[model samples]
Target: MTNNTQSLNSDIAAMAEKEFEGVYGRYRITSTDELEVQRYRLALLLCGVAFTAGLGQWLMIGPTWAWLWLLPMSIGLGLALNWIHIYLRPLHQALKLLWALGCLGAVVMAWSVGTDTMLSTVTAEPAWIWAIGPLFAALTGVGFKEFFCFGRPEAIGLTLLIPIALLGHLSGLMSGSIVMGLLGSAALLLLVLALRKFGMDAAADVGDKSVFAYLSNPQANEAL
Candidate 1:
């Protein structure tokens, strides 16, 4: 029984190793630390986009058609993020499609917001209704991806935007711009925290490797 169990375990381990190699065979990931850094960089870029967009709306920082810029900005960022991931590992087809849909949703949301603001007879309610739908849909895709791939905090941070938008519209606590700015600011804070955590984790990893090396070398232990 023990020999059979050992053979089964070896088979499973071999299959797992082969699968992992196949998945990353085409990509060159220098280290786990590099991958984590890339992920954090993507998060920071997204945080910047959210914060800038919120600030723009709050300050009324651009012309009525300014939202159109979001289409290109979102697509560019989505592509860049995906590019980074693809360089590190092979991506599922569904993941690629999700990113594409997110970019499309962003474009649609920007168009809807711009058009509604220009043409709506009743401004506040209709504008938010139309705007929130696409924004939430896009964010759902983002949150789902983040939850599965990046981290729970990022997913939760994005998911919170749904309620933030809904309550901001209904309660009239502040303008949409102010609410968005506040939420975006919160997301930015979360990103900062996540980055720091990942940095610390990487440092711990280095320390652990150093300790392992020292402990494994009998000569070094003897010198100590």
Candidate 2:
């Protein structure tokens, strides 16, 4: 009788476990997803390096050739945006489009003024902000999504500092020193956020994969 009771209990536990998995298995993190998350984090780290290099160049703290970092900065931002897992597909698509447009504008601006004077041209012409603004806008979107998901102080700082610095420069409302200070702060915040992400579990950055599935299948989701 004792042996029979033990077997019955074990069977019951197995059934319950199977049922729980059936319902929630979609939420499980797979190895491939985790690997992808690592790639995304690496892209973010690259972005941080580029931002730091650009800031140093802006402040004349680095070699004049450091401005060449802009190419890698654009590449890193594109990769990061592509790999970021957002539940809303449309928003994700929009961010990529913005990045592309910004790149196109940058190329046009560079062509118009020549690579040698690109930086000086932008400084002399406030209207060029419109050309580069989309790139920063997409970056701001990334910062906002990170803050919304993780509530990180650095993420929120990037979201706020970017627009402030750009608008300040565009409107000529803030002194050059003030704009420089804000941009420097933004670069530091981005580096901090990127480094901190590495210490976090990849699942946190990947978010709820089930929600992505639900959103992807509108008809099936509505049927439920």
Q: Which candidate number has the best TM-score? A: 2
lDDT of 2 at 124: 74
Worst 10 residues of 2 by lDDT: 16-25
Candidate 1 TM-score, C-alpha based: 0.44
TM-score versus the correct structure, for each prediction: 0.44, 0.85
The positional error of residue 166 in candidate 2, measured at the CA in angstroms, is 0.7
Model 1: how far residue 191 lies from native, Å: 5.3
Query: What lDDT score belongs to each candidate, Candidate 1 first?
Result: 0.47, 0.82
Worst 10 residues of 1 by lDDT: 18-27
Error of 1 at 99 (Å): 4.8
Q: Candidate 2, which segments miss by more than 4 Å at Cα?
A: 1-25, 61-64, 220-224
Which residues of candidate 1, in runs, are more than 4 Å off? 1-47, 50-54, 60-69, 80-155, 166-178, 190-224
Error of 2 at 120 (Å): 1.7
